[model samples]
Target: MNQLGHLKQFRSSVPRKRSMGRRKIEMKTIDKEPARLVTFAKRRVGLFNKANELSTLCGAEVVILLFSESGKVYSFGHPNVNSILDKFLVQNFLPEENVPKIMEESVQGTKNSQVVKHEIMTELLSKVGVEKKRGKALDQQREEETLLGGEWWQGPIEDLDLPKLNHLMLSIHGFIELAMAKANMLTLGTKNGCK
Candidate 1:
C-alpha cells in the first residue's frame, strides 16, 4: 500500500517541521487581524477540500464547521450540512458564551423582521408626503411579490405576467413597510425602557 498517496491526500495536514531539533520552536502569539485572516483563509480552503475528498472516497457523509481564531465561521459538508450541525447542536446543548456579542446582536436584530420593515417604510412615506392609500396599495403589491420570490428590479416590467408582476411589486412594498414598522416599534420600546 502506498502511504505516499495518503500524505499527498492531506498535504495541508503536515505541520511545518523545525529544521533543527531538541530546542522547542519559539512562537509568538498572533496579534494582527490581517495576518490571522490570511492564515485562516489558506487553512480553511485546505480543510474544506480535504473534507470533500474524504466524503467522496469513503462513501461517508462529512460536515465540518470551523471558527477562526479571530471569530469568523467557515463550514463544509457532504449531503445536508445544516442537519448535521443541528444534530450536533442538540447533542451538545452548549452555550456559545465565547462567541462575540456583536454576532449575537446581529442575529437577534434580524428576528421580528417584518415589523421592523413596516416602520422604515412608514417613516419614508411620511417624509415623502405619500398618501396612505397609495402606500397601502404599494405595500399589498410588495407582500404578494415576496411570496413569489425574486428580485423585482432586474426584469422588464411589461414582460411579466400581470398577476406575477403585480405580486412581486406588492411583496417588495409590503416587506419594506413591515420592516420599517417593526424597526420603529423596536426603537421606541428600547427608548422607553431606557428612560
Candidate 2:
C-alpha cells in the first residue's frame, strides 16, 4: 500500500454530496391545484409583510385586493378597508359642490392642450418653410448651372473663380446632405408605422 493506493481507496470510500437546498423556480401559472394553493398562501403572506413594512416606514395608507383560487376575496389595508374605499369613492365620484371646481380644472386642461397643439403646429410650419426655401435655392442653382451650358460639377474646377467654386460646392453638398437626411427620416418613419 503506497500513498497513491491509499488516496485511491479514500476517494472510493467517500460518499457523494447531495444537494438539499431550494432551487430557483421559473415564474409561470401553476397547473397543479395543490401546488398553486401552497404557492398562493406563501406569496400572500410575503405580500402582506411587504405592505405592512411600506405603510410603517412611509406613514402612508396602503390597500391590496386579491382573489383566491376558490374565488374568495382577500384584502389588506392600513386604517381599515371600508374607510379607504369610502375616501376613494368620495374623491373620484364628487359631490355637487365639487362639480364646478372639477369643471374649471377640465376647462383649464383643455386650454393648456390647445396651446401645446398650436405651438407644435407653428414649429412644424416653420420647418416646412425652411424646407421650401432650401428647395427653391437648389432649383435656382440647377437652373443657373444649366444656363451656363453644362453641369457645374462636370466643368473643370480650376477654370472657375475660387469664390464661385467654393459657393457652388458648399451649396450643392449642403442641399444634397439635408435632402438625403430628410428622405431617410421619412423612410424610417413610414417603416416604423409613424405618420
Candidate 3:
C-alpha cells in the first residue's frame, strides 16, 4: 500500500488515546514543509476514507471541501453537491419581498387572460343578439305577407303560395326558437357560475 493507504489502514488499528498526540501534531503546527505536507496528505486521505465509510454505513451522501496551505482548493462529493445545494438554495433561500413580486406576475397573467376571454364572450353575445333581431324582423315581414296574400303561402313564397309560405314560416320559427334557446343558455352561463 501507499503511505496514505497504510496510514488509513493503521489509523483505526491504533487506539484513539494512543494516536491522539500524533493526530494533534498532524492537524496543528509542524516545523518542516515535508513533515506538514506529509501529515496533510495522509490525514486528508484518512478523512476521505472515513467519509466513505460513513456514507456506506449510514446510506448518506458525503461531500468534502479542503484548502491546502499553498492556497489551492480540493473538493469531493458523492453526487454533485453543488447542484443539490443550488436547488436547495433556490427553493428555500428567496427573500420575502421577492415572493410577492412573483405572485403579482402570476396574478397579472391570469387577469389578462380572463379579460381577453371576457371580451371574446361579449363580442359573441352581441353577434347572437343581432342575429336574433334580424330573424324576428324577417319572421314579421313573412307573417304580414301571409296576411295580405291570403293564398300566397300555398306552394312557395317565391311562387306566391300561401300554404307553403305558412309552412316555411313555421320552419323559420322553429329554427329561431332553437337558436334563441342556445343563445339563452350561453347568456345564462355567462351570468351564473361559469368561466
Task: Residues 1-195, candidate 1: write the lDDT tens digits.
Answer: 489888787877878776875676347655798886776788689988987886676655678879776677677878756444333433232246523432343345554433533454476568557657767876786687778885565788777787766767776887897797677657644643431
Number of the predicted model whose TM-score against the real structure is largest? 2
RMSD of each: 22.0, 20.1, 29.5
TM-score of each: 0.30, 0.39, 0.34
Highest lDDT against the true fold, candidate: 2
Q: Can you write out model 3's per-residue Cα lDDT over 80-172, one digit (the tens) per residue?
A: 445433333334443465445444543466655435434545876897799788779867877887788754545545784576667677767
Which parts of model 3 have CA positions greater than 4 angstroms off?
A: 1-27, 91-195
Better candidate by lDDT, 2 or 3: 2
lDDT of each: 0.62, 0.71, 0.64
Q: What does candidate 2's lDDT look like per residue over 138-161, in tens digits?
A: 789779878978675666878778
Q: How many pairs of residues collide in model 2?
A: 0
Q: Residue 117 deviation, candidate 3, in Å? A: 44
Superposed model 2: Cα runs more than 4 Å off: 1-22, 94-195
- Candidate 1 lDDT score relative to the true structure: 0.62
Model 3's alpha-carbon lDDT is 0.64
